[model samples]
Target chain A: MSILSLTAVELGRKIKAKEVSVSEAVEAVLAQIETYDKEYNCYISVDREGARTRARKVQKLIDSGELTGQLAGVPMAVKDNICTKGLLTTCGSKILESFVPTYSAQAVLNLENAGAVIIGKTNMDEFAMGSTTETSAFGVTKNPWNTQHVPGGSSGGSCAAVAADECFFALGSDTGGSIRQPASFCGVTGLKPTYGTVSRYGLVAYASSLDQIGPVAKDVTDCAAVLEAIASYDPKDSTSIKRDDYDFALALTEDVKGLRIGIPKDYFTDGLDQNVRAAVQSAARLLEENGAFVEEFDLSLVQYAIPAYYVIASAEAGSNLARFDGVKYAYRSKDSKGLHEMYKKTRSEGFGEEVRRRIMLGSFVLSSGYYDAYYLKALRTRKLIKNEFDKAFEKYDVILAPAAPTTAPRLGESLIDPVKMYLSDIYTVAVNLAGLPAMSVPCGVDLKGLPIGVQLIADCFKEKNIIRAGYSIEQAVSREKCEAARAAESKATEARN
Target chain B: MADIITDEMIDYVSILAKLELTPAEKEQAKNDMAKMLDYVDMLNELDTSGTEPMYHVFPVSNVFREDVVVNGDDSEGMLKNAPERKDNFYKVPRTVD
Candidate 1:
């Protein structure tokens, strides 16, 4: 039964051995979705028949001993922002509620080519603007651990699907901590690949420079497997990094024997929640015990990351989202008389408040007289932040920090002040601004029994180092006692039942 | 930074972006836009002398490719997605009407 609890690699081995047929495993996932999705709000839609059909094809291939694809029969889900052919790629917004993509995203194409079965598109922050997926025009996705708390966002749904066993792995887009923050809250491993590492062809543009499609899975190896499947250049997206240039997954081994991890002195400041701090410190100690050096490095430039990230991401978001005018592919205002009215009514009524807020902020910063004052300056400051990271990597193999300042907060706690919600992505956003690769792995749990994640940020195109360090922690934490601690509270419930 | 970005400025941006905003919403935007801009202006205090501005983190050159007929000619797929399409093109409102 631990095959249900195994890594994607282990599961793939079982499938290849025909010990577990693809259809049986997929049906079990579907059954789990049916049983638990109501509690977590993890899925926007579940393609039961389509998943069964896909699973049957995979099963047939396995029966013929023709399992050539690396991820044959693996079940994966995608964030709704990805353009899966014929699927409603709504980006969790009302505007494109009826719009479906005619073409698949290159990343999705790669996954399908490798025989990964996509079950459905997961929910997200509308247009990937907000930190909490509560910004979705559709309902908010609840944290699988505690329904009352948020799973973090905007990749909350993807992270939850994997954490709650709705799917083995899910593809999520990280514009600004969308993937890692949610993964942290949901007790999963999520990777934000270096900016160009993953193709952004059909990501429904949200701050294009910051956006990247990454993997969320139960652990680091699955994250690496999903990353390997999706990471490649496409002619369609100019920003896509060619795999020939950087074979990031090729360097995955337990070789962090002498690798140094920088713990930014600024990160462990006065206000970091004591439990989250303790959890990360404990993880650092564990890594130290495992024969790696953890030393404090000063990234003074990171203090400005939040402000710089907002200026740059919002400005780019304003430009990218401008294409969503009613005249184009999405939902148009029906009753409008002219072009102007149509554009106004369509976007005004169509966009969620968070989307509108970003667009408005984006517009304001890039507007006349303020262009040189805001947008241009932020671009310059972004370089400084990247320089800090680039310089730090010269000294340290990877940078270690808390995935989030704290564990998942109660759903409505920070939703009121939109500014405060943006602050939640503080630690993870700078990695986006710098376009670095980072992974969040479940290192430890707090006193409250909530899972805590430690972030390992590697240099650009050096995802192997990320997984190298992350996997060490993953293996150390995979022991019987460590694993038991995760399920102990649940075992108590079983005792009561 | 002004306490208010004028309706005229919003109109200017809308024109540049090919988007449109309403008068009442424009008034609301004028207020909201000001707060957002002021937040951005907070960065003006930082000193960035001798910094090389970079748009992308990866040092990729302009990825110009030879323009060829790599058309997405999946007509049935395209037409199937359109709310209203006729004869392979998207159906639109008449310009004069």
Candidate 2:
């Protein structure tokens, strides 16, 4: 098998054992990207030279008997929103198209310190404002499973890259289901670490409270490994939680015995496709059969999740994005009459339609007369959602839900109606609102052969619980596939006999 | 739901957001914002009288740090990305009349 197709864990082990060289693995990934990325549109920038230099340095370290870090020699991709020193970190917007940060984000530094070579920066929705990557100024990323469908957004490129084996794993920032939705659509394992558990020092803020940088990879194990590398506290991000180092990789035991998995009834309600609902329900059953207790529960506050998320996210986005106004380090309008005109023209020209729409809504909601009516009310509703999750966690260790309402939609199907696109994130946004860790793992495929993902959510700092539960679900799914293959093999033998 | 967003409201919001919208774009924004507001009006159905607002997920307040310089001054590196720069300062249009 090609080295590019191996999981991050397997590749790391092989590279360390000298059975595979880091250069060869990097070359394989580069070759794959060269051949496939043009069609997939998964990457915005590929740092081929930088990756080669890092891989060669890692090989030298391995030969000299001084190799260290869990992910040594593993090639990875980062979402374009995360700042990389001297690399083009355009958050998939024309405003910052030429903007390159002199300093790297904390997560990037952490990944590099762990010896993971970042091969490229992936495309994303403009400032992470949309559900489908169609809003990206660069271009929409296609699902690797089928070229006609979209890899869900705003971290669509990260998920697509991992799904296409352009890289072993990729880093994606989650604000209102950006990471998990795409992972679900692309048939990969994506984890959104509990808010504040991962540092957001250089992650361009979409919504400060909801934004988190997490991992997308081939499976739950690789997701856990990448999460371990990037999860840390940095003083630069004031919201970053100061905690002892966690070994997420050590928590990936396929033992869900006695674990309580709560299936929220609202998630299975109308608007969810039958295929997606069936796949998630089967995931719950798999966990139950593995000795875990599965029960239906009521999270009554779910209906308000979408409204509150949009209100708060747009408001925060307006305030955070107010920094770009033809000044400092972004695009500027050459035909400006004056200072005010320049600011208006620069932003109007630089931002995409969805981005401008969100900014307008944000500004409107935060305006003097509307603050109490919209923004404040949304915050209060956010508290109610958190209270509901807190109540649910008392009886359940983790909640099971469909990651998205359906499998990957056709490329332009969701973009026509904005509200319809917002509804796509119904099941996953509540976890971010509650500041909990959640993951999307591939469980089954739809009738169209597109992958379906099931979400597992845990209370704050309880990522280990979900990881353990997710590991069990992944094993059971694979076991079912194996059993089907065996049955087919025996049937064929009998037919021949 | 009331028609909370009008053309005037869109223009006012555009100015506040520092965005220059064309006449057609203004109409589109008005309609889009109206639909979004209609959707968010779902919050009006909830009774949150006693619930406190949660601006942040974490219950963190007043996170202070030592008043020491961690990153040394790198004016050259910071200015490298400036669209227009002059001697470590960003160049912009004159503000005073």
Candidate 3:
């Protein structure tokens, strides 16, 4: 296979064994980006010189035997929201279009320390305020599966880059399904680790309580390996957690024996597309055949997740985004007479329609009369959702559901009606609200040729359960493909005879 | 609650959000906010009477450390991207009338 076609771990192994040099790998990916990125719009910025420079340094370290990790000398992309010292980190917003960080995000720093070469920054929704990348000041990233459709947002560019082989792997942030939903749409693997497992030090905050940095890659193993490399505790971020185990890759044993998987009956109700529902259900059945005990259960309060998620996320987004006041490291209006005018004009001109709406909603909810009615009510409902997940986990090791309600929607289909877009995040948002780890693995392709994702969720810090289940599901899917191909070949031979 | 998203409400919230919206944007905001609030009113269906509000996912309280600086300051790097700067400080519009 071509170097660009190899998974991140496969490429890493090749680089470590001298089968492929780090520079050669970096050059291959840059070449791929040069050819296809304009069509896909998967990147906000591609650091060609930076990637080449880092590749040379990483190759030197590899030769000297100083850096020997699985990801050492591997080239990767970063979502724009995660800071890269000199790269423009716009968070897909015009407010900070020219802003560059003086330091890297803790997760990016961790990967760099492990000898991973930074390629560039990917595109995202403006302040992560929208489900589709259409809200970005920059243009939307097209789904690699079909250019007419969206590569879900706000980590759409990261997932698209991985799917299109523009990067070996990419880092993305999840604050209510940004990573997993896009990963699903792009037919790649993405993991949203339990909140606080990955430090959010330099991540452009959307919702401080919900944001997390995770990996998007070609397969479950690459996702696990990338997660293992970046998951770290940092004193810099007060919410960062010190965990006992960070060996996420070791969970890829492809063993689902006696695994208890719960299929939430609520996820299969109205609004879920029949094809997407069947794809997830069949994946669960495959696991059951592999000795996993799968059962349907009532995961109530599901209907409340969307309303609560939007309220809490918008409220926190409004608070977190208040720092962009046209003073420090952001665009300032030229036609402002006074300080308050400067703030108002800069924000009004800089932010997009979706961002403005969310901020306005946030202000209204947190205003005097509605704080208890909306924001507090959402928070209380959030606690109830977490309690439901906790109750479900007591009887199940992992929860299986569809990553998105349907396959990737055609571009312009979702943006017109914002509430319809929010409803698409139904399956993935509750995982974030409960602060749990979830992985989206491509299970099957729909009749329209778009891929469907099966989400594997585990309770906080129990990443191994979901990772193991995800790996097994991937294995079973690949085996089924092989058997189908073999039968087709035999049928062809019989026809020839 | 039906007509809660009035022009007055949008104007008040826009000021609170520090956004100077045009008349068209204000009208659009009124309609959108009304729809969103109508949808968000669904949360009222659930009676969360005794549940404590979860401000954060974890039970983390005050995270304190010894009062020591870990890294030296690079004022130049920090100010490099400032929209307007003068003598190691961000320059903003005149606040004093």
Candidate 4:
């Protein structure tokens, strides 16, 4: 197998043991990108020459007997919204088409410090606003599994890159399921850490309170390893939670005996596709077989999660995005009557339709007369949802649900229907609302062969619980695939005899 | 409950958001905004009379740091991304004019 096919953890071990040079591994990934990224469109910018230089430096350190961090020499990709000094960090928006940051995001720095060579910046929804990457000004990123379908958005490029094996791992920012949903669509493992666990210092703000940086990788183990490398408290981020050491990779054990898992009834109702429902149901049963005590429960407040999420997210996005007013570092309008005209023209011309709609909605909700009715009401509803999760966690160690209502939609299916696009985030948004940790693990594939994922959510800072359960499900699914393959082989031999 | 978004409301919000929407875009915005507001109006069913709104997830108050400069000014690096700059300052259209 090509070195690119090895998981980040496996590649790290090989690099440490001198089995593979860092430059060789980086070359394998760059070769994969050259081979497949034209069709997948998973990257916005591939740092071909820069990554090769970084890999050589890492190889030198290893040669000198210097101890590097875990993930040494692993090739990685970061979502475009996260700043990488001297690299283009457009949030898939035309406004920042030429904007390059002078500094890297705290998470990107953490990954680099741990010896991960960043191969490229991945594509995302414009301003991380849409559920599908179709809204990206660059172009839509197609799902690797089915090019006719979308790789779920905002973090679509990051997830698709991992799915396509373009990179060993990728960093993705989640706000209302951006990370987990795309991970589901692309059949990769993604984790949206508990709010404040990961620093947001250099991540482009979308919905400040809801946005979080996390990992997208080939499997649960790789996800855990990347999370350990990036999750840290940085003083630069006011919301970053100060912490002691957290070893996420050490938390991955496939033992779930007597673990309490809650299945929220709300997640399985009305809009869920039958195949997704069956896959998630079987995932829950698989957990039960592993000695996890699973039961159904009511989280009625989840019904309000979508409405509240849109209101809060758009409101913050409106405020956060106000900085791009044809001033300082963004696109400036050439034809402008005055300063006011320049501001208006620049924004209208630069922002896409969905971004404009969100800014308008955000302005309306926070408008003087409507503040109490929309913004404030959503905040209260958010509190209620958090309380419900708090109550549920008292009884259950983790919650299991579908990552998305359906598999990846056709490339442009959700784009035309704005409300329909928002509904795609129904199953995963509540975790962000409640400020909890959640992950999407590949459970099975739908009838169309598109992948399905089941979400495992845990209370604040309890990522270990979900990682453990996700590891169990991952193991069970792999075992079943082995058995089925062996059965097919034996049947073929018998028929030939 | 009726179509709350109107041409006047769209114009008002466009100005507030500093966006110059064309007449065609304004019409589309009116319709899209009306639909989205109607959907978000689902929150009105719940009575949150006594509930306190949560602005931030963690209960943090006035985070204080040491009175020292951790990162020095990077004026040169900051100017690298400026679309139009003169020396160390950003150049904008004449405001007083």
Candidate 5:
């Protein structure tokens, strides 16, 4: 068997049984990158020598019967926003393009302790602000399945690399659907663990309240294993919760007979593409067939979630990014006669258009005159949205909805109309607003043949249910299903050619 | 809904946050402030009577633990990245002097 094409769990077993040497595994993955990276652009930087060195060391340990932990020598990619001590973490923004962190993020630190080898940092939306990866300061990440269409953002590069078999799994931070949206676009499994379930110590803060790191992988089991490695409280992150719940991987089961899945009626609104709606309904029926009861539930409050999220995220982003002045670190303006011109010129030149727009919007809302009206009221409505989900969860084990309103739109399709593009994150943003755990698993494909993902949300700290149902309902039993879902992606590429 | 975060208010906020904004930033911020306030008017119509405002949505609160040092003061590499420094302290322009 070509173990190179296997999921992370299978590869772990092979490495444990001595069927695959760590060097062989690492060499094979590295060779694949050497062969296909130029075509996929899934990787922003390749740590070829570093990864090989780590792999050899792990192989020596395994040969000496000293192999320990669940993920020893598992090669993985990480989104750029999550800091790597020695690597450049641009977070897809030019303001910090030259900034390299001195401290690794808690999640990355945990993965390293478990013997995971970091290969490179992936690309993303500028400060994770866009629905598509087109906004990246680094070149846009193309979907591996079809290079013409974008891989989703802000975790698009991570998802693309996984889908293209560049790594066993990748870590992605989700705030306003950055991880899962890209996973769906790439036809991969991405989980956004419960907020604060994973440490935020190394994350370049986009919106502190909403940012949480999670995993994207080829299957649900791999997702669970990666999550287990990284999910823990860090002394560095005061918001992280120290929980006894260390057995997330052990809880993945097919026994979802008593599971109650909620289907939100509002998610199937007029603008939702017919194919996406059908795929979700079909997946729900499959769950019902597996002895899981499916009930339609109300999510009227989710309608307000996107608007509320924009205000809150923009407000927080405005504050967080304000630290990027010319004095502290990063790019500074030249020929400045005064300190004021220095900061203004630097920010104006360093930040992208979208980042500037958000920063301004954020500053506006947080300004003294408007705080009571915008930021305060958005928080109040944010409470209402969370309350509505809390009420729905009381009746259901999981809430299922389309991850986005449609399949990946053409790269430039929504560039002219920012609102229409923002609406694409309409379904996924509420999970962030509510601070709940959610995931995107491949459901099916649209008529155009781009992958369509359906999301499942659960209450905080109840992330097990989200993955359990996701694993149960995953329809990609064959690689052909993945290829079919990615058909539109390649066709777009051919059209461009 | 005037974008009325004045130059003095902007300076005060920057000081509070330990950020330094420039003069052009102050003028741009003033205009941006007004636009944002104009947009905030959209929320004024929503009836939120008796609705208890939520600061966080998580069910668990009071999650902070007592401060306990876990590791060493590893500043060898941290100081390398600092733009300006003298002795062990970050060097800055003098205000008092």
Candidate 6:
């Protein structure tokens, strides 16, 4: 098999066995990027020289038995929002287009310490404010499954890179479905660990409370392995959880027997495409056939999730984004007359339309007369949404839902109506609000040949449940496909006879 | 929801956000914000009587630690990306005469 086709763990094993050198692996992915990236725009930057230099050093460490992790010497991409020292870490916005951090994010540091080679930064939504990567200042990342369709955002580039084999796996931040939706669109596996499971030290603050960095990979096993490499406790981020166990790979059992999976009835209502519904239902049935007790349950407050998420996320974004001015390490306006003018002109010139809209919304919600009516009410609504999820978890070990209402939309369709783009996040946003662990695993392809993802959600810090269930779902889905393909072949032979 | 988002409101909020919008941009912002506000107003449908606002998803607060500095002053490294810099400082527009 081509070295480019190997999963990260497979490549790592080959590198360890000396069958595949780290340099060869890095070279293979870089060559793939050179071939495919122009068409897909999967990456904002590709670090060819740096990755080659790191591969040489990492190969030596592997040879000396100093680095022995499963991800060691594996080439991986990082979402642009995550800081990587000296590598241009634009958060898919002109504001920080030239900005490179002096230090790496805690997640990046953890991955590097595990011996993963940095491929480069992937594209994302500007300040991670939009649902489609079309908002990127660099360029939109197209779905590898179908170029006309969008790879969902703001981790669109990360998911697209994995789907196109531009990298073995990638790290993506999830704030209101940024990672999961894109993963679903691009037909990849993405995990949003329980809030605080992964430290967000250097992840550019979109909505600090909702953001968690996780993995986008080719399969559940790679996602688990990547998550294991990055999930950690850090003193730098106060929200970082000190977990008792970080061994996510141990949860990769293809057994869902007796696992209680809830199908939120509210999620299956109107606006869901029929193909997506059928595919997701098939996933549920597959899990059920594996001895999982799947049942429809009322996950109330579904409609409130979008509104509450926007209000709270935008409020936090407004505050978090206030740091960008003319003086610091971001783009500054040259036409400003004075200090106030500079700040105003710089932000107006630097930010995109969607980002500017969110900041304004945030400021309006937090304004004095409206704070109690809007901001406070939204927070209270958030508590109610979290309460509903908490109540659901009391019965179900894992909740099953469609990762998105439909398959990837054609480019420029969702962006024209911002609210429509926001509504596409209905199924995934509540998980972020409740700080639960969720994943999007590609279950089946749609009529248009776009992939449909089934989201598996577990209670906070119960990543093992989702991981275990996700693995079983992957196994069952793939087995069903094989059986169907064989049946088709036999039928064709019989017809000829 | 009432149509409360006006041109004046957009201008005021943009100023608060430290953004200067063009006339066309302001009109677009006004329209977009009005739509978003109308949609988010659906939250008022749920009666959240006496429910405390969930500021943090996890119950973490006041995460105090040792006062010792972990990262020493790397002024040169920090200043490396500054848009305009003077000797050992990030230079900005003059605020005072």
Give the TM-score of each candidate: 0.93, 0.98, 0.99, 0.99, 0.88, 0.98
In the order shown, what is each candidate's alpha-carbon RMSD? Answer: 3.3, 1.1, 0.9, 1.0, 5.2, 1.2
**Would you give me the overall lDDT of model 5?**
0.79
lDDT against the true structure, each candidate: 0.82, 0.92, 0.92, 0.92, 0.79, 0.92
lDDT of 6 by residue, A1-497 (tens): 89988888898899889999999999899989989999999899988999999999999999999999999999999999999989999999999989989999999999999999999999999988887799999999999989999999889999999999999999999999999999999999999999998999999999998999999999999999999888988888999999999888898998889899999999999889999999999999988988999999999889999999999999999999999986887699996778999999889889998998899999999998899999999999999999998899999999999999989999999888999899999999999999999999999998889999999999998999999999998998888889999999999999999
DockQ of predicted model 1: 0.47
- Order the numbered candidates by DockQ, best leading: 3, 6, 2, 4, 1, 5
Q: Where does model 1 exceed 4 Å of error?
A: A244-255, A483-497, B2-32
Q: Write the per-residue lDDT of candidate 3 for residues A78-178, one digit (tens) a residue.
A: 99999999889999999999998988999999999889998889988898877778888999999999999999988999999999999999999999999
Give the interface RMSD values of the models in order: 2.4, 0.9, 0.8, 1.0, 4.2, 0.8
Evaluate residue A91 in candidate 5 and report its C-alpha lDDT on the 0 to 100 scale. 83
**Candidate 5 stretches greater than 4 Å from native:** A475-497, B1-45, B59-76, B82-97
Better by TM-score, candidate 5 or 2: 2
Compared with the true structure, model 3 gives a TM-score of 0.99
lDDT of 2 by residue, B17-50 (tens): 9999998999889889989999999899999999
Instruction: Provide the lDDT at A275 for model 3.
Output: 90
Which wins on DockQ, candidate 2 or candidate 4? 2
Q: Individual DockQ of the candidates? A: 0.47, 0.84, 0.89, 0.81, 0.29, 0.88
lDDT (10s digit) by residue, model 1, range A212-322: 999999887778778888888788898877655544456566556787988998998875889999878877777787788889978886667887888888889888888
The i-RMS of candidate 3 is 0.8
**In model 3 chain A, which range of ten residues has the least summed lDDT?**
A127-136
Model 2 fnat value = 0.82
Model 5's CAPRI class is acceptable
Clashing pairs in 4: none
